[model samples]
Target: MNTVTPVRFDNVNVGDALPALDLPPLSRLTLALYCGASGDHNPIHVDLDFAKEAGMPDVFAHGMLSMAWLGRALTDWVPQSALRDFNVRFAAITHVGESIRCTGTVTEKFEHDGERLVRVSLATTNEAGVQKLLGEAVLSLP
Candidate 1:
């Protein structure tokens, strides 16, 4: 498991970039495991035949899986206790065999409820540079 390093609020800047996380290429086994673990047995994600029947060429990765990767990217930089808000919007389908990369940049910094906070804009893109997900996160820093 990756561990987060504590980030001090005063040390961060609005434009500082978070370390990028590159996930391995998605595979059929990964889709199946994620389906089982997440209880999202939607055939479009794990059954190629069902996907084809539904007009898709093949099964695709789950949207939440990509979101989880983005979350991992954030938590890998700062502890989960620092997170105050997180959300994502799926932008494109993530097909099997595609490698996903998660990235973020600090967009804002301020004090909320007497606590220092930072807002980050986040994204996940495929190896081809096509966006798969877009999101934002707010974290309380030490």
Candidate 2:
């Protein structure tokens, strides 16, 4: 396996692309694992049959899992950077087994109160380039 290293950015700037990340399909087991880790036990996430009966084709991936990739991309690129803020709104449901590509670009950078911060505009897309329009994230880095 190739070793992953953090990219050292001297003074954050605009137009920088965060490293790309690929996530596997969503599954009942995956949701269970996420629930164990995050302490979110919303039945809609793990109960597949219930989900199907509720009009969803299958158990959907956790919104956080999709957004977690975005956070990982940032930390992967800036290993030492501290994340000050992160947020994402679920725009669409991502079914299991879909390939999600996490990506981001630096939208702005500036110093606030003596702390350097970089604002990144983040998004995720599927192999076919469908984002599910799932969500957008802004990460503040120091």
lDDT per model vs. reference:
0.92, 0.70
Single out the weakest 10-residue window by summed lDDT for candidate 2: 1-10
lDDT of 2 by residue, 1-142 (tens): 2226433336556897766887776556778898789888877788877887888877887788777777777667665336766766677777777888888888777677666677777778878887654333444443
After best superposition, candidate 2 residue 63: deviation in angstroms? 0.6
lDDT of 1 by residue, 1-142 (tens): 4444468898999999999999998999999999999999999998888999999999999999999899889988888889999989999999889999999999999998999999999999999899989999999998
Residue 21 in model 1: lDDT: 96
Angstrom error at residue 125, model 2: 1.2
> Top TM-score: which candidate number?
1
For every candidate in turn, the CA RMSD to the true structure comes to: 1.3, 3.1
Instruction: Name the top lDDT candidate.
Output: 1
